[model samples]
Target: MASTSVSKKRKREAGDDAKASFVLSTQPKSQLGPVLANFPSVKPSKSTTFSCYQTGGNAKALGDADDAEFAELPTLIAGETDSVDFHSANQPTGCRYLVGVHDKKTGITTIRPAPVHTLARDVKALKSLEPIAVSVLQRLEARAALGETFGTKKAKLAIKAQERNKVDVSAMETVVDHLQESIQKSTQALPSKEEAQATADSTRLVPPYNAEATVPSEVYPLHNIIPEAEWRTLAATPFLVVGQMQRTPLLPFQRSQWINQHLHSICESSSPSKTNIKILLYISYMMFFRKFAIQSNLGKVVLEEKLASMSPVVADGLLSRFTESARSSSKPQFTSQKETLLLTHMFALCLRVDDYATDTELIARDLSQSTQSINTLFKSMGCQITKLTLTDLKRLGLPDGAAGTKRALLKVPLEFPKPRGKRRRK
Candidate 1:
């Protein structure tokens, strides 16, 4: 019985020594037993080892989410400095903690210990002395998450103010100098207008923005998912190209070039005329700039009124194209390839503009289809129609209160449905 007590006492003393060796460890070594139990067969790699406070079990437990959180933290190997001993290299006695310093001008990140107070400190070193520890970062994350949850204008402003307060006065003192330097660099980097024009003139085989120029879409329109017959019909149909109506056939590439030219022209012109708006351009504008196009009541009214002027045949064509383009690639259907490809590009842009939710009213008007049909088209692309609450609109940077209006927004998922294979015979 006395021998058994001695053995247990020795084991306890060994455990205490192990715990004492780990500095700044929030989690105890005993807690790692469960983590190791989850993967008992797996062993730590011999090449790499636990650095100081890190343990093999704890390292293994850091999944994708935890890795993302620590992705910004820069690493510094022991070999970089000769001051530390190689025999007991796991702990860097000199460096109690490491800090990541980012240079905005050079776009380079460096890992080093926090700056200590010195009389010969430069502006850069003084700025880097701000207390940006892990605890401070965690607090900032928590505050930001809280503001997002509350989602009020005042909450957002308050959070911003709090963040500003966190910055040291020494750091704030250099902000003006940094801003001026960045502005001067940016101005110097821009090429002169005459030089840009000369470069553009010299680079071209044909004139810039040529309607006859073939785009990649002509070769592979939406990966040839749409029917060739429908594509041929679209190619044969007369349409507008660069402000002129063409009776001759316009290939997919020609139409694409025309749209690009029209969009460019719109950017150059302060106010684009209604007469200059082509069917495809109008649809593209509405899809890609939903918030900008329909934020104001006047803009929405004007846009919808423009749709009223569209001929029945043009509207029919729009409906055919949009429906085909929006349809799932998994579903078997006959469609116009050019229209499908064009709308596919527009949909991609729309998805990016609004994150996941897209407005369908503008495109619905272009299609001359009911809201139900538009919703069905979005659903085919694996999207769900979700109504945006007042808070949602506020969070999205819409006008204050937005007159208490609600919109039926389409929620898009990153993943789409995969085509199913036929079952084998029993």
Candidate 2:
């Protein structure tokens, strides 16, 4: 009966997708209609009923539902964010839309869409109903709550695939167009067949053109050029061209891989002063020598060579100093046992005690000094050791001097030790 009534109505007004009485209009200031004012505080339900619908990406007012008038609404590309599904019997016949809210803390997405018309009419309090708004503010708020993935549809996958396909096809088409253009240009540039044959025939070695007057002598530079013939025949040259650039020796210090990177650039940029380069080379050599001089393995010959590299005068002076002082003598030291004991005592006494008269008889006791040589011992004593000792002072005697405290210093000896032969300076 209902189908017959709808058929009669449609025929009366020229059949339309929706009959006039049932035609939905969202032309008011808000697509949500009077629902906003009616339900100022429409709390969402535990079972989410809304989802966001992305209309053709432009900022078109959804109130212009006429644009999609013939098509069904909410062409849901990807939705299923939750497990709850509505029964088929409860689904709406007209266009449907989505509304959603997001909960950021829980990462939950909730959406509600246009409810069944039967449900809308059955409910007394409209506060239970939530109408879908054209403004995206509701969708934005929902996203903030649930995050984008929880309740949102992935409708963009199909759209992205389409865009990718379009790009590929456009690129292929452009390549084909360019190839066609090049092919056409080449074809137009080609000479006609009759002219091509005549030109080829003219280049051939026929009579009156070369030796048979066929090939022209003037066409080749090698045949008649005197300068080229002279150059080919000449064996010895009189003049020479020398390059102005003289290579600067890159010193070993600057040969490090790290330094090489910048060394050439720095050298090229430097002012043309050979003196400065020489000075820098000498300085690096000296620095290297100074660092290596104390090494035990260094030989005198090598040292001399290094010193001579700097200057002959420097080498001479260095050798003189080496032989006189720094050089170690190979002669074995011969010290009598008593001489050794006496020298040891002298070293210790000098460290702990200050001034005292040198005793010649005591020093000459059993060592090889035919006569007392107290002066030699005194001369070898060096500076008095500043390190003070109680026994040393008592033995030498005194807060006043060592004249009366002999028993106080039995541990220390009074006699000065004999010194060995002096190392004479050259």
lDDT of 1: 0.40
Best by lDDT: 1
Per-residue lDDT of model 2, residues 148-249, tens digit only: 345335544544444465545555875897899999999997889778755754543211111222222222122121123222322211111111122223
Flag regions of model 1 displaced more than 4 Å.
1-345, 354-356, 400-426
lDDT of 2: 0.35
Model 2 misplaced regions, further than 4 Å:
1-266, 297-300, 305-311, 314-426
Instruction: Write down the TM-score for model 2.
Output: 0.16
Tens digits of per-residue lDDT for model 1, 178-201: 989999999997889878755754
Report the number of the highest-TM-score candidate: 1
CA shift at 414, candidate 1, in angstroms? 3.8
